[model samples]
Target: MKILYINAMGPYEAWPQAGVFVSERVAALRKNGVDVTACSYYQINSPAVQRVVTRNGGPDLGTPIAQQAGVTYGIRKIPNGFFSAAMQRFRPNFWEKRIARQVRRDMEESKADLIHLHWIWPMGLGVMRYCRETGVPYVLTCHGGDIYSDMKDMRKRPYILKMLEGAAAVEFVSKALLESAKELGYSGKNAAVVYNGIRTSVFYPARQEHPGKTVVGFAGVMILRKGIDYLPEIFRRIQELIPGEIHFYMIGSGVLREEIEKKMAGLPVDFLGTIPSEKLAERFNEMDILLLPSRQEGYGCVIKEAQACGAVPIGRDVDGIREAVDGFGSLIAYTGDDDAFISAFAEETAAYVSGEKPIDRAAMEAQAARCSWEERQKDSIAIYQRILGKAD
Candidate 1:
């Protein structure tokens, strides 16, 4: 089957994380003998874009776009300048201002059996509009921001409802995400709870000699939504209760780095900055427990990455996160339950590091298994076939 994949910022923006996901899915489809092609919205004209493309070569548009452009997730790729300007000029939802003639022309040029949309916001929304105008069948995969943002805000509500009404199928990364979609006015017959796949070969479990000191770490951007601001409080509480040696590792670079450093001054923390995707596993293996205290999460792929490295995860008990943690690690309250969270963190940390409760290597393997690219693509292909049959 021939597929035309659409992602507006292109793959260059949602790299390693979102970019890697798309690349692996396309590879799996090829391995299964399905032909896939992609059309990206952003121009691959800059050195920044070219460098990442060189690092991670791609006949597939998504992976190269992300690897070179540095877009890790949907939230990171909210284009601010010209892209945003164009969006304002051509309002996709308002029928008076239909999809641009160029987008429709492009879709027609890249004729395929089906169109698979990765994230339905900014660019994905435009692609969907083109598909609708051309009568080409398409599917929308709900990746956090697309669904979660729609539920809380009215601005994107109509567009999301239209997506539900028109899509051949709807996909959510976790069971919680599925529920969130339903709550957000998606009453589609083809709703599916598909977990994102992790490349086990790239993010494999490693046997590490744990230092006597337990290390708690957070990897990813330094941002408010990630709940990095709460780290200092958690660390201070843990220090007061747990008498054993402890260390903290804060990974990744973002706008909030200065604020995080200011809040965590003089604390037992190692700010390793941002490491390349190839080197992230080493940092995961170094941690006794990985903490993700995000206020919102689509599904914490990092938890899966951490679990793959045999690092226990303790995260905030929010939507997709609870699904990710699901007994593999501890989930605590998002707010107002700091004491409870700190206590649970202490228990899980000491238990794993001290070997009081044997880390379930099998469960870790099981979680990683759920995220394989093959499984993700198999479901995607099946959906494509069904949509094509409907077109017939």
Candidate 2:
């Protein structure tokens, strides 16, 4: 089957980590003998876009663009400068039209049997319109931000609902996300809960030799949505209880890094800015515990990544996170309750440090196995086949 995958940003663009996930999914589908082509807009101001412009001539309008792995990319340059900034601030639809025109051109050239849209914001409206007009089937996947934030905007809700109404199938990364869509009055057909998976080959367990030290770590974007601001107080309480026995490591970067550092001043925390994917397994293995205190998570893929390396995850008891840590790790209080969260962290840390509670390497591995890319691929392929009326 010829399939077209549409996303806002992937590996070589604005969000490289998300691009890695998309690359893995495409690789898995190709391995199963499916023909998949991916298309993404050129993310303005991203390092990857800068590199592309430096190496190749900037993207041309209405042309078949670059290729990565086996997937073809259609790159379009959006309007820049003061006028573009005004359009973005006053009329976001101006940008969506450019996205739609490019996507329509790409779809016409590829003649794909199906389209799978990754997120439902600017891209979805355009792609869904093209699919509706051209009589092609497309599936929409709500990957966190669209459902959590974009859908909350009154101006965007109608467009979002129209996309859902037009899609052949709608996939959510977690059950919590599916419920959120429903609560927003999305009475769509053929909805499914498909959790994001980890590449086990890259994220599996390793033998660590850190002796006499319990390392608690946080991995992912250090943004407010991640509840990173609360880390300082939590760490302070942990240190007050078990000084010198525990150490903190944060493995990622974002806008709030400086503020987080300021709050965590004089603490035992080490900021290990962003680590590459190749070395992530080693970092995960180094941690005795991985903390994911997200205020709102779609599906914390890092939770599974850390667990694959045998780092027990302790996360907030919120939507998608609660499910990710259900059978594998500990769930503390909700995002804002610092006292309850601190109490839970201190208790769990004390138990692990004192040898009263042991890290179950076997159990963590088992959970990771269930959430691996191979398993996710199986579900995704089945969804594709079902949508195509080719299911056995």
* Top TM-score hit: 2
* Per-residue accuracy of model 1 over 1-392 as CA lDDT, tens digit each: 68776554344333334344555666677777887665544533344544554566422233334332222222222223444334644553542123334456555665676777677664556656666777777777777766776445676677767776787787777777778777777785788776777667667766566556677899876767788877887777667755678889998765678888999897899998766655778777777789888888888878888888878898888978887776788787745776666666656666666677676866775677567667677887787888888778
What are the lDDT figures for the candidates, one per model?
A: 0.68, 0.75
Lowest summed lDDT over 10 consecutive residues: which window, candidate 1?
Answer: 68-77
Per-candidate TM equals: 0.81, 0.87
Name the top lDDT candidate.
2
Per-residue CA lDDT of candidate 2, range 1-392, in tens?
78888766454432345445665677777778788777675535445444555466442122224544345556554434545545655665556666678777777787778888887777776777677777778888887889989998887787788888778888898999988988897985679887778877778878585777778889888788898887887778777776456789988876678889999989778897766765778888888888877889998888888888888888888878987876777787755566887778767766666668876778878778677666787777888888788522
In candidate 2, the residue pairs with backbone N, CA or C atoms under 3 Å apart (3 or more residues apart, or in different chains) clash, namely 11-19
Q: Give the TM-score of candidate 1.
A: 0.81
Error of 2 at 175 (Å): 0.4
| Candidate 2 wrong stretches, greater than 4 Å | 12-15, 43-74, 80-92, 390-392
